[model samples]
Target: WARHGIMTTNLAEAYNAILRKLRPLPLTAIVEGIMYRTTMWMRTRRAVTLQQMSNAQTPFCKKMAEYLQEKANKARFHTVITIGNIRQRWEVTCRTKGGFGSSTGVITHEVTLGHESDNTCSCSCNKPKLLHKPCSHVLAACAKIKLDSTSYVSTFYLKDRVLNV
Candidate 1:
């Protein structure tokens, strides 16, 4: 559970319930029941993914896009600076005030883009590490370069990837 980052017992309880029901059935019946349930789950997920893809967005992407939009709005006054000719490194500075009548403070973060094939990126805030998604700073840099935000997203969040799984 720790390896999978699961902090709740809901999944365990569900599995136990399923097992309890299946225990009364014959071997073949139990196998069939589990298989049917799994198939239905996969089918339902695939159908939803297809619907989302038709709209040109996966559920993950849509959620991340919303988060990025909110963060971008808050970061309206921030600036993005290109590091070099590589076009893979950028610096983003976010300005914030402690409180009313307080002096403004600046926090700078670096975003490093991944290889072209992967289309992934990371930021100094470590959000990408925890969430497995691009941070706000990375999105802000992408906006500055007029780059498509989706292009930097990991394929793991894509509909095609989910379908393939």
Candidate 2:
């Protein structure tokens, strides 16, 4: 924002100064440091509230919101489900969206199912694209069918790994 001239040098300097005090710390320390800074800064506002934070209507705030939304949009999912009898089969699902105009925009999904006898999931997402946990969609589907979703989740994978990767 400073480079784009959207913010003044003085404002950038203040942010940098606070960051300097935070940069040398470990991840947890840096998070706590920033949390303290945020508390102090909000205290100066006199009327800060959850509504105010949620209502960040400035252009910069909107851009930040869009960026975070993009990050969340890139998550992947994997899981096992009871398809026949008491037998379990693995499934993988991926989601992606692209395009400009509403008419041209499209949301794409690729889902794969695994065979128990072969110990393989048929979805492309199940290959080198391994996810750390079952997606909520799979969990929801299981719940809708009165099945235990937890039994399908592998303890080794987390949403963050599936999302970040």
lDDT of 1 by residue, 1-165 (tens): 443243565776877677797888899998898899899999988886666676753345455557767866865677899895765898898765564343557788898877667777888887776667667787788788777666665567766777677
Where does model 1 exceed 4 Å of error? 1-47, 57-61, 71-75, 85-87, 96-103, 115-118
Per-residue alpha-carbon lDDT of candidate 2 for residues 1-165, written as tens digits (9 for 90 to 100) = 353223455875886686997777798998898899887775654342322444535212333335333433433232334444444442323333454434545332233323323322233333212442334444433433565433333432222222222
| TM-score of model 2 vs. true structure | 0.25
Per-model TM-score on C-alpha atoms? 0.56, 0.25
Worst 10 residues of 1 by lDDT: 1-10
Clashes of each: 0, 4
Highest lDDT: give the candidate number.
1
